[model samples]
Target: MFIGAVPKEVVGQVLATVPFDAWGNVYVGCSGSFRFDRAVKMRHPECRVYSNDVSLLTCSIGALAMGREFPVKFKGALAFVEPAIDGLDFRGRVAAVMVAAAMGNFTGKNEYAQVHFRHYREHFRTFVDQALPKLDALVAEIKIEEFYAGDFLEQADRAENSGGGMACFAPTYKGGYERIYKLVNENVEWPAPKYGIWNPDSLPALIVSLEERHIPYCVISDQLLADRTPTTEWRGSNKPVYTYSSNQAASLRRRLPNEVPFKYTPVEPAAITAESKVSMCVVDSKRMTYLKNVYLTKGIEHTTGQINCLVLIDGALAGGFIFAQTRFGDKTRELYMLSDFAIARERRLSKLIPMIATCREVIQPINRRLLIKVEYIVTTAFTTKPVSMKYRGIFELDKRTADHLQYQSAVRNQSIQDVFHEWLRKYAGQGGKPDRQGQAARAEAAGEECALHDAAGV
Candidate 1:
């Protein structure tokens, strides 16, 4: 019910459109500030109101402000009080359950530092002390069955099964402040009962689960409504809202099959060859367009130099590596940095080593007229330790800094060449021949190498 920053008129419009009946019950989860709860109660004076929150201090303040009896002990209870009236009649009994921005603030230790926790606790105390006394009339007008102190998802699960009504949830959207916090933090385990909006996948998973459970639901967001495609007509600011109903639940159960499809397709290993050809050539803008679509991370805007090399396996585009002039320091005088690189997900790691090694051949000739006589290729690995170690093995580890693991380009291309030679030896031992197709690819690779050497007068 915390209507932070939203105009009162917008709140009124949203409350007016909620699918509810007179004298029904309404439940508000994560009822911070309880402003929206008060507004809802005022709109439907006869309806019994129930609220649940994790903080006892906030709940106590809410009780005092509204002139309601505060619970003596709060032990993560799912529901504050039972519905004043309950029966098999699911439609008109329970009105609309509104969950407004009810995501947990406790992301983890890395992001939720000590200072943040201190500030939050101090702010809560100050706000409650100043605001609780002024809300007496707002609290007294509506009957609150109980204020449960616990996780929102647990309460929501209970509410969903306790007969059907319109359930509305406005969770913190993905890619918001919370997501940024999670991304910045390291060694953090998000505590659960994690609901939709906890992670990017959680919301979709929640919807799929609801569909499987026969809980009909639709996602609503201000962006979605502003685009003029709402699941249900509503009057309010285009704030994103997700609603599920018993009727939709029934339909979803009927439409979806019992089993869910497997989430991923198995990738077949790439064939190894004694004459497996990897040729690197400067890519045109058109090819760059195609690479951007397939590269795992980074787009053209992040890249800085013209020396973008396309890696072709035999004759198809298999991978790419882009180099940029160093913009960080005087290092530009001696380095051509590897800005972005990725192999197709379907490609094998055996192929990756050789493909990466090809950068050595590609870089040498390009440096002939380049601003800097490229002495070293540098890059940072920002992934987990194991993955960073893998990168370090391929590109010799230079140093471990606070922000990233830095790697120096190998002195010789021998690491990649050794891997390729080993694979070729195995292939030859297995009686594989250098066939016409393989020979043609090898010839093409040799020709490209000759062209680079010729251009560099090497």
Candidate 2:
């Protein structure tokens, strides 16, 4: 129920601070509305772009408004679930960091009235839970709070002086409810439409959860507290105070808003499957590395032959993207190499946690075998070696952390040297790669059979 808004001046500052160009694509994340079409005209009015909204009404309005306002074409639609960002290619990639999230309207009758009444202000807190205790037990539960109920909130929702229907948030329902508002606390973690009104905080939740890993963001805030609110509430005049300030009108540099500082890059859990041109040079190099290093000798007949392909998910795309390997079951078992993952350099581990959860979900069904368990092979950073993990696994790289064989710790070998030998010895124990050995042995065998060419006349 946070009712404050960043002023228009502040909004100008925030938008101006955003860095977008023709080179990189920008990603916009919002729950419902946006505030910068006119500003975009005032700012970089030349860029052609696509915009989308989850609310059908807002998307239509924005499309119409953008078409009329900017000579440049603006295209896109809104969606309840964040639309997948891949499948689009353009000259520039950018970040449309939105400030309005968790603001989708609600449906309960009495619940809808809280947006207006003082008694229910606390009820509008962003993160509402079904079982979670409410800050104010007296306020109704979400089922009661979400919709605009007429019975419980008769005082605030009574008919206007005209004696007709009141404005928005005032449900005519005797009990059932419907409408939307900006809320706090709940966000993309629980992305269904019921929590509360859309607000500034929800944007960060979306960025971190979905786009944070791959995209750079510039926030577009919808602040209600600025000097230009409709009047006091939603029913006021639709026009804002600064209809269209002069292009040179001083842009307001904003004070820091309440948002978590992003710090870590996100991880893409699975790989994407799409048709695109891949060069033979790159594909061969990848196959060479995996074949020589991973599947050479040993019991590779087990998995490499068993699971012929590999899939990669670059979570840094828009939230993230999936990359899949294919087309070459031609040889033994075919496999696709990989692409370095993309992620935001400033998000936290908490943001990436979901990626792992999602990756597991994507591969879980296929990764597991029916009779004898097919192990889940995960690629992790070298730093993660210290933590104890319980699962049958193999390291993508050799680090001292993974060890079950005790003989490697024996004397005549210093601890560090012994550990190295332990891993190297076990790894090399399988001998030369099949590809390498096959080439050399075949060469030698050919030479021996052709002694006449090697030595003398005949």
Candidate 3:
């Protein structure tokens, strides 16, 4: 059901500007429609084109489009693909790798009906069984050397290291929803929902990783914003194609070599003494949203009864936690769920205990006014820690939410209180000395006396 084809204009731009040399291999990752693969084959018949994908259905489609025989068995497709690529001779050839990554999960119309994991697994297995042999034979006959079936990042790394070639990534765009809807309106039957969209933020991380590894690459995306525009002239005429090449290809690489992956030094536990004042206060929604976007993976979803708390160290935003009303089956006696709880990566380990203590303290007063019982706190393992056997009373796994194991902790119980008090002692120790108000008062009095003396002298 995923949209397989990239726009022809985009493909043309890629074909026109991509720095592929004669006798070079074009390695395509997530080659959905094989549009780029076929184009490369026609343009440079002498050069080999290699494609990689994780999905068997997609691989089969790619094979069919390339006029290659489908693989008979799916089980050994992975076994054959990896070895074949590893065996290829990349010496003295211009290898251009294209990756059309499948990075999103789709919600099919039959998703609710397809309840069991085994059912989905078996359904996919059947297609793999049918497609593997044909795909294997297709790879053998065509100029394309291999069809890798695994993680795109891993394969990309391999292609960069072994082939030392130019890499192209055709990630999904923001306007993809509209395109998919249009396709559906035209009765162009695609899967119910396409999951993968190229997030602009993800590009910098990828660029940083490639740069760190010294891999020469280019991103062929319409969705990439103008900020990432290379200094060189864009070659494509039809589509507004933005290309970022390595320093070897263009000057953009030289301008900003270390643009992303923020630098930070890890804070030591001993650095935060007992007297260190850890201030917790309510933060604005805007600040909470900013932190969530930067730190949390999925970002924040505004919900009812949501409270955002910021943990400040020396008046600087060190960390934060978010609490929202729980949605666990009908028992709504003012229960809450904790989520988007995080500290700056640099201060994670050292600040964890303090962050938890701060969260507990901040939530206590908020609960008092609403007469909120806070019977139990339910949080997913994706966002919080796992429910270990040692803390049975404090937390337990709720299996009803099957997709992600939800961990629930009873907040009203003595066990959780004891745990929090113990952590508070272990992390935040005794209080620091009170403010110097007495000294300030005396100074003010002396100043008044000086003013009177000055008046009498006058």
Candidate 4:
């Protein structure tokens, strides 16, 4: 331990006892992430999507990593989503946010913060004298509340409150009880937000507290990520100290409007680029409904994307690929059918690969920041209760194997243009076979449908 580093477990127990949290979820503020970086994606496989858009890294390089000459159509954005309600089993769905520099304290207090309070104080009066405390105090209060409402309340309420009973938090010895009491009582407000090199003692306490409350949180500490460099500019009087792409949903706007009327204007987070996508699926007509999910999973399996979407081409695919109607902000997205075909295993061979290769052609490649080779990565698939899970990881596709199918300019001179045109044809033609439930719900929102028709002998 350094001259003044305290045991993290002691502090974690103290904070846990205070019961900080809103519904037992640790809400963390953070700096944005460069791209996919985590165990979740590495361990699961369904997240793979073939993006015909700007790569997350090396944004300027274009889709170079997806080097090819197939008919590539560009998708402005990609998105992956899961049901928010009971998305995973109780123990699996616990969402933990760790705010690091820029979002969480970049000081010793926040275990993941890389800089200390002293380093932060070097900048100005705002951090050390004011902002830091407000931030920390808010965290403390929230942590306590999470315990009361989500942890303890759930314990006394139901068995399904995300492991909210005695088992998650049975017993543990806290050694520095007297010491933590002393630290908590210290009225010594930092001269500035302590900004020396960050210390990691804070996370242990948060983890400890979470155990006590039966709340599950994943650690996303700044000290534990790729982008960690101490700079005063990222910090400010009001902005969070850090930000990450995953936490963007919450961090971008620290506060939201309340149900009650307020005197001041209540602003909302800036709208994100909602994804507009489509997929083509081939299935045995007799089993369409039963095998639809499996077919959809297959498209995701074969594509290289951050998000995947599919359009089923039964006998209905007379034109091309069709895009269902949806509007994102002022931008209207179009869907097209790049190819047309019948339902067969051979179709997967001739159609699926060519279709995927086409999408790969148009997208720019990733080159900057922490670069990772995509060729070796594979998505892991597993199912645990509420939702079938998918994540990303490293795997290999051997080009030297006799099974490897070589392509002609990435699939017989097929270009991104071919892909997009096909997609547009399908999207503009007609919507998918009637979605009874979805139709009933969208009855209120004004919506339009598009379709495409194109056919060739198999």
Estimate the Cα RMSD of every predicted model relative to the unseen true structure: 18.0, 25.0, 16.9, 23.9
Query: What TM-score number comes out for model 3?
Result: 0.38
Q: Tens-digit lDDT track for model 1 on 131-162?
A: 33344344564355666554444444444354
For model 1, what is the C-alpha lDDT against the true structure? 0.39
Q: What is the lDDT of candidate 4?
A: 0.22
Best by TM-score: 3
For this target, which candidate reaches the highest lDDT against the unseen true structure?
Answer: 3
* Backbone clash tally (model 2): 76
TM-score for each of the candidates: 0.37, 0.25, 0.38, 0.19
Which is the better candidate, 1 or 4, if ranked by TM-score?
1
For model 2, give the 10-residue run with minimal summed lDDT: 449-458
Number of the candidate with higher TM-score, 2 or 4: 2
Query: Rank order by lDDT, top first?
Result: 3, 1, 2, 4
Q: How many clashes (backbone N, Cα, C below 3 Å) per candidate?
A: 8, 76, 17, 103
The local distance difference test score of model 3 is: 0.42
Which 10 consecutive positions of candidate 3 have the poorest summed lDDT? 91-100
TM-score of 2: 0.25
Give lDDT tens digits, candidate 4, residues 1-458: 01111123322322333222222322321101212111112222322211111111111111222221111111111001012212322111111011112222342455445454334324323332343444333322221112111111123222223322121221122223123223211321211111111133433333322322223333332233222111111222233222112112122222211111111110111110112222333222222211111122111111122212223222122111211121321112222221122222111111332343334332112111113212211111111112111011111221221111111122213343455345344322332233222232233222223222121100
